[model samples]
Structures are given as structure tokens and as C-alpha cells.
Target: MEFWIIVALTSVIVTLAVAWPLLRAPKKSTELTDDYDMRVYRDQLSEVDHDLARGVLSEEEAKQVRTEVSRRVLAADASASTSAAEIRIDSSRKTNLTALAVMAVFLLGGASGTYYLIGSAGTADQPLAQRLSALQTARDNRLSQKEVETRVGNITEMEDKATDDYKKLVAKLREAVKQRPDDLRGLNFLVQNEARLGRFAAAHQAKSRAITISGSKATGTDYTDLAELMIIAAGGYVSPEAEAALAQAFAKDPEDPRARYYSGLDLAQNGRADIAYKVWINLLDEGPEDAPWIAPIRGQIADVALMAGIRLAPPPPLAGPTADQIKNAANMSEKDRRKLINGMVRQLSERLASGGGTADEWARLIRAYGVLGETEKAKKIWGEAKLKFASNAKGLGLIKEAATSAGVAD
Candidate 1:
């Protein structure tokens, strides 16, 4: 009977010990009072001020003495407040708690030993499930702690690697551009780095060289990428060339949303509100059917239309792709495409010369020069085009002629 009682008591104690941690509120020491020393210092400061005003010291001596006292008071105040409240509370309370806890542990241990020696001669077996549950809980806690540590370490390593690689890439790009001043690839890399670092103006300057290199033969990818970067660099300020490039790229691959959308933006930037409106109208009419780009394109078209004083109806149903549209104008029988493109160039140039050109029109002139391989002349004309035609009606009309010429079906 004694042994049975002992076993029951042992089980109860074991159960309580296991249950205590789960049921107990976490132990937290109270926050400590801040600035006890500051309170004393403040009292001392009041005393010094009183003494000074009462003529206990001459004014000059009081001033000097007050300065030194003030310094000491502030130092004492800072010292009292610097340690965190939580740390101070833990230091003060843990000492007392530790002593009581040690006493309780020894008492409990003694009672357990006495019961085992005198009251129960046989071992009290625990259920396998309970024992397994305890073991699993302990294992899970250890694994969770280890996993957190591992993940933190990995994140730290990744951060260090990223920083180092970024620096190396920047250095390599600079060196490459310096070695080969005309290297578009190097300039592109530098531009990419500048953009990443948010040095947008610098990126634009670097990207300009790449744009010049791309010239008339700029691939669709090249034109689109450069235009996007240029806008970001300028915080959306663009020249006629940027808009023209965007338009030409769209004419080549109307299916590309980014090219089509930014082409409208470029037009608006260079002060060709009318042509921009029309370009957007065409974009909305001709863009990929049911594409995500349609809404924004429509929105931009509406805005530009408002500015251009052009009331646009809903865009017309898109015409199906024509063979002329699909065939590369550049690849056409050299005689045929060249004749068409040349006729466009001559007719547009004459029109612009008769009056002036729009930003879009200027872009068309540049495109004509690019297609004709007269890059330097194209450049000279583009530079002068904008300054000459701020808002002349003839200038915009000329630009419309240029657009029609450059964007003609193969």
C-alpha cells in the first residue's frame, strides 16, 4: 500500500513538473526606474544656482564653477539613463530570484529521494506515449532554434556576396569603358550599374553613346531597352530622338507593348502633342488584342488627345496584318524597299524644308537618314530640328509628312 501511494505521488510530481512550463506565464522582471542619479544631479544643480545668485561666489567665479558643475551633472544623468531598463531590472531581480529558486530545488529533490528510498522499492514506469511526446517536443525546439540560426547565417552571407559583386561590376564597367571609349557593351554595363545605384543622369549620359552606336540599325531590343533606360535617367524628360526611336521600333514590331506605349510618351515629351495623339490612336487600334497594355495605352491616348485638341473616337477595328507589314523593309528586294524608303526620305525632307518639322517629324527625318546610312547628316538635322520648330503649324505638318514617309508599308 505504501509503495502504491509512493508511485502515485511520483507520477503526480512528474506530471506537475512537465505541466508547469506549459501552463506558467513567462518570467519577466519589472522595468527599472530611470535616472535616479539624474534626480540627485538636478538637486545639486538647483543648489549651485542658488549659491551663485546669493553671492556666495563672485559672478565670474560662479560662471566658471557653474560650467564644471553642469558638465558633471549631465555626465551623471547620462550614466544613469544609458543602461536599458530591461537589463537593469533583470540584474536587480534575478539575484533574489536565484536564491529562492535554489532553495526550492533542493527541497524538492530531497523529498523525491526520500520517497524513492523509503516509500517505493520498485520503479514507476512512465507511459511510452508520454515519454515519446516529451522527447519529440524537446527535439522540435532544438531544431527550430538551429533552423533560425542557419537561415540568418545564409542571409548574411548572401548580403555580403551581393555587395562585393556590385562593387566589382562597377569597377569592371568603368575600366572597360575607359579602355574602349566606343564600346557600346561596356557603356551599356556602366549604364546598368548607374541605374541600379539610382544615378539616373549619369546612366543617361552613359547610355547616349550606346544609342548613337545603335543609330539607324538599332535592333528592336536595343531601341526599346535604351528608350526605357533613358526615360528613367531623365526622370521622364526625353528628346525627339528618344521618341522617334520608340516610334520606329513600334512601326517595326507593333506587337511590343513597351515600345508602343513609350513612343507616345516620347512624342508628348518633345512637344508633338498632335502626332503623339495620333500615334497612341494607332497603337490602341493596332496593339496586341486583349493585351494588358491596352488600358494604359487608351488612357495615354485620351490624355494626349485632350492636349492636342483632337477629339478621337474609339479606335477603329484593327486591320489584319498585310504582307507588306510583315516583310522586313530592310530585306525587301534592295531595289524595291530602297526605292520606297528613298522616296519617303526625299518627299519628307522637302516637306520639312518648306516649313519645319514636329518632334515626331524630326524623328522621321532621323529614321530616313538612318535607313539611308547617312548617320552623321541624320544627327546634324535632328539636333537643329527641335530648336527650329517650337510650334510652327507648318513644322507640325512637315512632321506628319515625315511620319507617313518613315512608317510606310514595305
Candidate 2:
């Protein structure tokens, strides 16, 4: 009610200001008809008489000058009378009260209607400090990894799709790790196989053990892997435990993509979509298209941008294998699929070597070599990327993230 009252008052004040000129009586024309001009003509007539007395002008000349001055005086008087009559007529004319009313109504009604339609009518004012406090409270109250997992149910269904040989291998690996619990290599293998089989809880446990064993030698990737498994286990929720792991990853390497992506997720879930949107948008723009986080970031970024009060367009699709080509590869033999992948990798490598592609493309090449178990090539590419982006901190960060994922970064 108070808001409406203030708005009404303001509108009235503005309307009065705008209409004030038209509301008052018009001033009489003050130009050319004042007594000053008549005085000047009278002085000219006196000058004519003085000139005649001093014999400077003939009698005929004096008579002619006086006649001209008198004629001008009469003409000016007539113009002044006509102007006064027009002024009187104007003053007597009625004001356009209807137009004034319409203007006032439009100003008030238009503004009120616009506010009612789009403004938050009756919602309590939320100051910056209050909003920040609320976000902090939400963060403090967020669900833990265990709680989220319970809500989403167990995520071990991928084990059903494992082949018999793969299952036997994973089972043997698990036993091997059980027998030699302190062996980091065995633990790492167990974590990979468990995650492949969709036993994310077990995978994260194994990864945590490996990180503990490695201690000071553990890379950011180790903590990132642990966080990734936890998030997967919790059905994509970045739990408190996962956030802690991501923090550890950042402590090791601030450029770690997995850690950065998960941290952004945590921020978004805790009601800081503005910050999250910046993080995710940068990650998407600087992507090695095959980064594990790319697909998920792409999927959620549009919605996140909207939440942050941004109208972002979806990024153009990255150049890659088409749907038809991917479908064809699915039916190919393992060797054939590997050959196709190798061909694609070779093309990217050649492009980067000859044409000097973007930092993201270079990163993609390094990560692809890592995927193919060509660590030597990945390391060489990582070295070249460092030199190429020597002066560019952001580009180096992006490339370093891929190198870390490829096990080639220092």
C-alpha cells in the first residue's frame, strides 16, 4: 500500500510539472510594442524640429520627417492593440482539461500496470547481506554423500552389463587388493574396475585408500577421482564429502577441471548460480571436447544461466563424429573401432602440428593419446603445449588440466 501511495504521489508531481506551462495564462507579446520604441520615434521627431531650427534641414524636409515619425507611432500603436486583443482571447480560451486528464491517467495507469505484471508485488525486500546469509545457511544444511546416496538408491546396476570375463577379472582384482591392501597400483586398478562396474562407493573407497598411501606424492587427479566417484554414487549430487575432496584437489592443482566443475556444482546447489554460471561457462568455452565434465556442463549450463538472470545461447556443437558415424562404429569389431579412433586422433594431431589449433584442441589431442595408452605421445604434446601457451595463464591452465588427466603434468 505504501509503495502504491508513493508511486501515485510521484506520478502526480511529474504530471503537474509537465503541464504547468500549458496550465498558466500565456504572457502578452513583449517584443516590438513597448513604450521604448515609441520614445525613440518621439526623439526622432524632436531631432527633426531641432534640425529645422538650426537650418540644417529645409522646412519641407522637417515636415516630411515629422510625418514619417508620426505614421510609425500610429502603426506601432495599432500593432500593440491587436496583440493585446489576441492575448485577451487566448486567456479566455478553455484549457484542454480532457487531454491533461488522459496524460495523467496514462502515466499512472501504465506505470502501475507494468509494475503489477512484472514486479514482485508484496515480496519482502532481499538485501545483498540477507541473500548471502540465506545461501550460507543452505550450504550448511546440504545433504551429505551418504544421505544423497540413500535417497537415490544404490548405483551398482552397471555390473549387470559386465561380460563374464570382465566380471571375473574385476573379482580377481578386488581379491588381489584385499590381500595387499597397501599396494597403490592394485588399489588404483581396483578403483578403476569398480567404477567401470558401477560400484561407485567401493571405487571411491579404493581411490581414497590409494591417495592415503601415496600421501605427499598424490596428484590433484587422485582427489578429483575420489570426488567424481562420490558424486556419481550420489546420483550427481555434489555432497559435502565430495566438496571436501574437490577442495583437496584444488589445493594440489587449482586448474584441475574435475575439481573446478564439481566446485561449480556445489555453488549452484547452494544457491549461488551467479558464480556457478561464470565457472561453467568458462569451462565450456575452454573445453577439450572429450573432457569427462563437458557433456554434463553443456546439459545444465543453459538452465544455470537462466537462474543467474542471464539469457545465454547454447554453444554451437563441437566438430566431431556425427550420430550416423557413431552408430556405425558401435557395430564394428573392437579392432575396427580402435582403428577409427586412431584415425581421428591422427587427424587432430596433424591439424595441431601444422596449423596450430586452439588450446582446447591441443588439450583434446593430449587427452586422446592418454586414452589410447600412449603416455609418451601425451607427454610430448604436453611439453609442446606448455611452450606454445607460455605467456597465457588461462590457456596454460586449460592445457594443464588435460595433462593432469593424461598423467603427464608435473
**Most accurate candidate by lDDT:** 2
Candidate 2 RMSD computed on C-alpha atoms after optimal superposition onto the true structure: 13.1
Regions of candidate 1 where Cα sits further than 4 Å from its true position:
1-168, 182-184, 211-217, 241-260, 269-274, 289-299, 308-410
Residue-level lDDT tens digits of model 1 in 255-337: 67678667666556544677777766676667564554454444345457777888867644323335664476657787877
Q: lDDT tens string, model 2, 1-410?
A: 89888888998899899877667755555544787888899899989989999999999999988899999999999878877787765655444455677888888888889998999868999999998998888888888888877776544435765799999999899888989999998999898888878788888989999999999999998899899889878766788899889989999999987789888888877788899999987887888876766755654666578778999764443468889879999999999999999998998887666545667788899999999999989988886675455434566788899999999887
> Model 2: clashing residue pairs?
none
Root-mean-square deviation of every model: 34.1, 13.1
Worst 10 residues of 2 by lDDT: 386-395
Per-model C-alpha lDDT, please? Answer: 0.59, 0.81
Output the lDDT of residue 166, model 1. Answer: 85
